[model samples]
Every structure is written in structure tokens, then in C-alpha cells.
Target: MAEMIEYNCPSCGGKLEFDSTSQKMKCPFCDSIFEIDTIQQYYAEMENSDKSTMNWDTQAGTEWQDGEADKIGVYSCQSCGGDIVADSTTAASKCPYCDNPVVMTGSLSGDLKPDFVIPFKLDKKAAKEALNRYLDGKRLLPKVFRTENHIDEIKGVYVPVWLFDAGVNARMMYKAEKRRMWSDASYSYTETSYYSAVRAGKIDFELVPVDGSTKMDDDIMESIEPYRFNEAVDFQTAYLSGYMADRYDVSAEESIKRANERIKKSTEQIFAQTVKGYSSVVNESSRINLTNGKAKYALYPVWMLNTTWNGNKYTFAMNGQTGKFVGNLPVDKSAAIRWFAGITAVATAVLFGLSFLL
Candidate 1:
């Protein structure tokens, strides 16, 4: 049996949900709002006051057929006593029967606990508006895609990410060339001088995030540039309310390789900037050393939607904190052809007019 925690309003017993707009837990039924710290402290006292009781069930239910229970976890909802079936990586979700948000305590206990969490700043309304703005000006976008997209299915998810901090020392050597040209009445002369430029420096980076979920596409996640880490708060079960969160299936060791790749590229670029005043420069050799490397676990908020068009699936994501939206849309081939033809015709008319003037 899995343990679950559901936050209920102390005043009216209504389910409390974390409200992005207010940055606190608010009860929709009673309209009562409480600070996250207050709610956590209140619940802690309530838990300490309660007596522990355990009831065991010795009877066995219908056995799960072979391979039937793989990658599935079942938890009984405290609010409605309904069994919540979810994926193995799911850490938080809402009860379908009672609509009460639940956090699986065991999933986040011990080594699985996240160090920080950036709560959703923009609400669903903002995400929807951002999607509309994203699709508004795409002239080549298929018309059927807009009408068929399931916009209402958009969900806010807390994606687990690995944040890495490291200090890097880089040394780079570049082969550079300078060119000079001179023209005389009898002949033209060109001179090219080659030189070696070397740059060495130490750079430090903090909170370089890499997505920890295998279900998320790496390219799409990277397109959502950055997340504001200053607004992050200490992770709490209360913040998981009214949203879905995934546990980190990818280990820090695996994620560090990507972090190192990013750090290496950045270090090279920063060091290369110092090699200037050359017509052309080519990197000849480079070395980067990293020290004081560390990794932290955290959850970042994202709004995601999946839609299928013409037997293909399209995914869209919005940064819950920054309201930046990104998605790949299908283009109408016929419309693209017509647009190209129009451009060619206009160019031909302009060339004809120019030729006539000449």
C-alpha cells in the first residue's frame, strides 16, 4: 500500500489547491487562502497529535495475471477511498473520483526528495493565451489543426530536473590570419599573415538545468531557454497540490554528462571571444577542466499539451514561470507552394521593369 497526502481546508474541509495567481493554497469551495508555511506547520501539528493505527488485510484479491502489474502503482485515495492507478514515475496527481489532489509521500522520501521547487507563476489561463498568440501569425499553418487541437487538455506538470554547478578552467589556442590588400597601377597585391592566439580563463556556472524525465524531448525542453531560479522556494508536499509531478528516473550521473557538454561548449566560446582583431580564426586546440562540480534535484513547472493530427502527434509546451510557448506545427504544402509562386511572380515583374528602364 502507498501513502498519500491530501490537503484539506481547516475552515470548511474543502480541498485546497495551490493557486498560482495568489502564490498560496486556496480553497475553491470556501474561498479561504493560507500561506504555504502556515499550512505545512498546521498539518505537522495535526499529524503529531493523531495516533498511529495499522490495519492489515490478510485476504488476497484476484491475482494479477503475468506481466499485468508491471510499471503500474495503485494507491488508495484518502478522501474518497478510491484506488488511484498511475505510472511508476508519477509522484503527484489528483483523484479522478473525488478530484482531491494527492502527493505520494513515499515517492519523495529519503533520497528522492527534491531540494527546491519553482512553483507555477502563470496559471492555465495564461498558458492558453500564450498558445493563441503562438498560433495567431503562422500563415502557413494548417487550418484544420486549429479547429481539431484539444486545447482543453492542457495540463500543468512539475518536471524533475538536475541543476549542476561547476567551476571550469579553459585554455584554447587559435590559428588566426590577417589579410592586407594593395592595388597599384601595374599590379594588385594581397598579403596574408598568420598568427597563433591563445586564451586561458576560469569561469563558474550555477544552476545549469538538464531535464530528468525521459518522456520529455530534450530539444523541446532546451528551446524553453531558462527558468528564474531566484523565485524558487524550498520543496514542500503542499506545492504539489493540483498538479502532476514526475520522479527523477534519470540519475544525476547520467545527467552530468550533458551538463559537462554544455559547460565545455560555453567555456570554449567565452575563451574564444578574447581572440580578436583577426580576419579569420580557427580553433587549433582546447582543454577544459571542471572543479567543484555539484548536482541538485528540483522540479520546474511546465504547461504541456499533446495533440494528434493526420496520424502524427504534436506536442506543445509553455514555461509555467515565464509564459514562453513552443511547439511544432504542421505546414500546408499547397499554401506554401502558392506563397512561393506569388513571391516569384513579384520578383519577375520587378526584374522586367528594371530591364525596361535600362
Candidate 2:
């Protein structure tokens, strides 16, 4: 319930704020920009500041942790940032100036040391349009909702997500089998070949994300994906000057567990493909160890749109950072029935014509 506020940029006396498209504190006046700090970006910079591109596989010391300190306090974007005094749990928001969902990077970091992130470049307004366009395709929507549902309800929320990068050393020992068929008879050959392969490599992950909100439902929230993390910028409160933020419900440890699960699933897929042509199954001693484990913090933008139909709340979400759309919509059953009837009548006429020809 916090009101949207605005302030002038100190440098040019022009408007500045968190750019949903860039995830940075940007000054539209002078076009002065600063980057948002993430563990990956920070470490990447330190790891490769002396080199060309930041390489994740490079052996880095544990002292890499010290590089990231409270020295880089969360900046308040006066030009593009603001002092958001709203409660910690406010997840959705709007930019007072542009009236777009301006996700404070904090909302994405969600008070957790981020495991990873993919920040948003798209603003809340564009995100709302994504929702509107998503809604426009649903003809079964109520007329009132189709036309009157305000995009104003769209709140720019920076859903905190975890991105984990680590080197996994996997050792697997298993048995395999193949099946041969001839003359309608099948013969299964169990080849108990004790083969052990070493899988060790560093994984440079861009954005492994999770919702920072406990209020945001997982099934609905997860429908949206593909946040462009490459254009992410440094955290600035100025960018959030206009939007809203949700407090985190998912803990870092929990998110990490989820991320690890994802990594393991992906690993299994890779291994499965590596040992293709197996008919029965591949089973054995399998273990994965995470070396060079690291996490980055980021606030990605999302436009959260909430609507009510027949006194029931329906929700829609747009990736403020990437313009991806997702939500639960109230379908107009009456409209659907009418359309179905029309289609059915048309099909009936076509059938009659075909019968006459026959």
C-alpha cells in the first residue's frame, strides 16, 4: 500500500531510476549508467579483470569471498533510485515516473545471498502490455475483464533468484543391457560391463532463478521463464524509485537445494546422452561433488498483475526483466460456450454439404 514516489536526478536535474531493461541505475538525462553488483559479476570481474573475458573454470582461491564486502552498500538511486521505505515483503511495484513495475534489485536478491540471477531490462509498462496481449488472445474472458481490467494493477516486482556455479566431479559405475529382436522374438542381453568414467568440469551458469516471495505461488510463478541475464546491471535503489518489491519467502538454502536438483537433473541428462543406445537401464555408484561453488545475487524484474472476476482474485505475471508473460486467468465460461456453439454449427453445415455430395 505504499504510494509511488519520484525525485529528480542530482546530476542533470532530470529523471533517473532503475532500468528494468538494463537492471541498472541509469540516467535518462545524461545517460550515465552504473552496474549492479552480483557475486558472479563481481567475481567475474576480479577473476578476469586482469584477463580478457571472465572465465569460471579458472582456479580461484577461497579468498575470492573477501572481494565482496559491505563496502559496496546498496545504493539509493536518486536519479534512477529512491529510498523505498516500504515493508520488506512488498514484492510488486510501479515506477512513479513511468508508472512501470520497477523491481528493486533487493526484491530479487530478496534478502538472500543470491545463488544466481537474471536481471530484467523491460519496464513494468511493457510487461503489462505483455499481459494485456496475453489476455487479448483469450476470447473466453469476460467482457468486463477483457476491457476494464486495468494494467495499473501491474506491480513491478523483482523476484529474487539463486544462481549457482560450481565444478561437479562425478564418478559413476554401472551396468548396461541391449535388446535384439528377430522373427517376432526379443532377446535381452545383460552386459555387466563395469565401466567407470570421470566427469569433472566447471559449470558457468548465467541465471538459475527462484522466486523470492512466499506469497507468490510456485506453479503460477514458474510459468514465466527465459530472463535475459546478460544485460544485468549493478544494484541501485534509484532504479526502484518507482516500482514495488516483495519480501523473500524462499530461503537461500532452499533455493540452493532446488538449484542443485536442477544441476543434477541436467547432469543426468548429459550422462544419459553420453551413454546412449542402452535398452534396459544404466545403474551404479553415482556421486557428484561441487567444487568452486559460488552464488550471485540479483533482482530481476517482473510485472505482477492481479485482477478480480466475480469476486475471485486472478493473477498474471510478466517478467519485468525480460517481458515474459504468465498468470492464471478467469475464463468466461459463457463466452466459451457461445463460441463453441458457433463452431459446432459451422462444422455441421460442412458435414451436410459433404453428405449431399456423397
**lDDT winner:** 1
Q: How do all models score by TM-score?
A: 0.95, 0.59
Q: RMSD of model 1, in Å?
A: 2.0
Give per-residue CA lDDT, model 2, range 1-358, as digits (tens). 2223233444675544566555565667698765534323543455476653322242344543573632222223223444333444553454344443433344344354333334456776676668768877677777888777764466656666555565666655556666554443566454444443434443444356665567666665567776666666555444455555554656666777766776767766665556655565565666777553556656666677887766778888876655668777777888889999999999999999999999
lDDT of each: 0.89, 0.57
Worst 10 residues of 1 by lDDT: 51-60
> Candidate 1: misplaced stretches above 4 Å?
54-70, 355-358
Residues 1-358 of candidate 1 have per-residue lDDT tens digits of: 6677889999999889999999999999999999999999999998899957646362477877787775677788888888898877788998999988989877788999999999999998898888888989798998888878776478889999999999998889999999999999999998999999988888999999999999778787788859999999999989989999888889999999898899899888888888889999999999899874669999999999777888888889999999889999999999999999999999999999999999
